[model samples]
Target: MNLEILTPERKLYNGEVYGVQLPGVDGLFEVLEKHAPMVSALKAGKLKVLKDKSMSDTTSYAIQGGFVEVFHNKVTVLVEGAVPAEAGR
Candidate 1:
């Protein structure tokens, strides 16, 4: 799936990804290739990106809060703020 993570100041990430784990307001949820269309609220937490099906290649970010929309094999995340997990640490 194609994923884009955006903030008010900049675009954090934009690329193809195997899947993504989001910090939904209710808890955590994942979106994968060909996922059904939907939107959800997000909370402050880690957002993980699965670079491949193996799950070995991955990246993570700490997001403040946001909203996510999935449609047509694309995932768009609009957040208030975010930092790479490693950078945050």
Candidate 2:
């Protein structure tokens, strides 16, 4: 699946990913390749990107809050603010 994480100031990531773990308002949820179309609200937390099936190659970000839309094998995340998790250390 293709994933894009965007903020008002910039685009954080844009590329193909195996799956992604999001901080849904209700809790954590994951979107994978060929997922059903839907939209959801997100909370302030970590967003994990699964770069591949092995889950070894991955990345994470700390997002303030946002909305996510899944459609046609694409995942779009619009957040108020975000930064790579490691950057926060």
Candidate 2: residue 83 Cα off by (Å): 0.4
Tens-digit lDDT string for candidate 2 (1-89) = 99999999999999999999999999999999999999999999999999999988889999999899999999999999998899332
**What residue pairs are clashing in model 1?**
none
For the record, the alpha-carbon RMSD of candidate 1 to the native fold, in angstroms, is 1.7
Q: Each prediction's TM-score against the native?
A: 0.96, 0.95
Residue 40 in candidate 2 has what lDDT? 99
Q: Per-residue CA lDDT of candidate 1, range 12-82, in tens?
A: 99999999999999999999999999999999999999999998889999999989999999999999999
Listed per model in order, the count of residue pairs whose N, CA or C atoms clash below 3 Å is 0, 0
Assess each prediction's global lDDT (C-alpha) against the native: 0.96, 0.95
The regions of model 1 sitting more than 4 angstroms off are 87-89
Q: What is the C-alpha RMSD of each candidate to the true structure, in Å?
A: 1.7, 1.8
